[model samples]
Target chain A: GPKVLQIPSHQIIDMGQMVTLNCDPVSNHLYFYWYKQILGQQMEFLVNFYNGKVMEKSKLFKDQFSVERPDGSYFTLKIQPTALEDSAVYFCASSLGDKNTLYFGAGTRLSVL
Target chain B: GQQVKQSSPSLTVQEGGISILNCDYENDMFDYFAWYKKYPDNSPTLLISVRSNVDKREDGRLTVFLNKSGKHFSLHITASQPEDTAVYLCAAGARNNNAPRFGAGTKLSVKP
Candidate 1:
């Protein structure tokens, strides 16, 4: 089974600070996605990226959030000036293409204080 | 509104019994449906999936039945074992877009 590895399984940061969550998707995968899950809640879609561009994003994807996969490297989600409400487990996923099975990472738990 | 929904919050079944988990979606454009199993403190893993082209798909003791007309789908596990206890999450997605919307998940407890 292909694996999407997320770095720093747990991250604690102060509010108003910038934080970057990295994901190493399957080597052959082309589509990338990010999901947010708050405790005791459903997994919420944040954004999806393909061909180095963002394809679709949900309302949960705030203006302070951004995503990029630099030169075929690790895909990253950067939050500039984070807020307390941003505390949640962020899961990264990748798939071969649309209509394909998606591989997900273990999720990076972000705790904002 | 939740595009995908799992009405059941939890279920319990005896070993060797059949476990049926149901899910529903509100989107008509969704062409792909899948079921994911998640253990405690672990990431969700793909168990089985089916596209709208078919009504039913079977893999060993696991079966996925899709009812597109009703906007619903289900995952049925036969000869259920205690090891099968976990949280089941249903998801739906479209063809051109890869971001799948997941349900709230239903927790299953297979008692021996």
Candidate 2:
């Protein structure tokens, strides 16, 4: 099975600081996605990127949050001036296309204190 | 409001029995439905999926039954094993939609 690897499995950052989480998606995957889960709650959609652009984003994707995959490298999620509410496990996923099944990473748990 | 809902927070089933997980949705426009399984400290993995055009689909021991009129779908795992214990999450995707909405998830415990 193809795997999506997330770097820095756990991170603790101070509130108002900037934090970036990295995700290495499958080699041939075209569509990338980010999801957030807090505690034992449902996984909430954050944003999806394709062709180096944001295809769609949910309300949970605040203005402070941004995503980019520079030169087909790691897909990175940067939270500028992180907030306490932003503390959650962020999972990165990728698929051949929007209609295809996704391959997910273990997730990067971010804790903003 | 939650577009997709899984009412049961958890369920217990005996091994070799059937494990049925239910899900309900509020959207009629959704054409694709899927089920994902996840273990603790791991990401959810796709278990099975079905499009609106089909009412039921089966693969091995897993079966997905879709009821459009009821806006509900279910996953039935027959001959369930202890290894089948995991959290099950349901998701619905609309046509041309970029992302799918997910349910709160139901944790299943298969007792040996």
lDDT of 2 by residue, A82-111 (tens): 999999999999999787898999999999
Q: Write the per-residue lDDT of candidate 1 for residues A1-113, one digit (tens) a residue.
A: 78899999999999999999999999999999999999999999999999999999999999999999999999999999999999999999998986688899999999999
TM-score of each: 0.98, 0.97
Window of ten residues with lowest summed lDDT in model 1 chain A: A95-104
Docking class of 1: medium
Colliding pairs, model 2: none
Backbone clashes in model 1, listed as residue pairs: none
Could you tell me the TM-score of chain B in model 2?
0.98
Off by over 4 Å in 2: none
**Strongest candidate by DockQ:** 2
What class would a CAPRI assessor give candidate 2's docking? medium
All models, DockQ values? 0.78, 0.79
| TM-score of chain A considered alone, across all candidate predictions | 0.99, 0.99
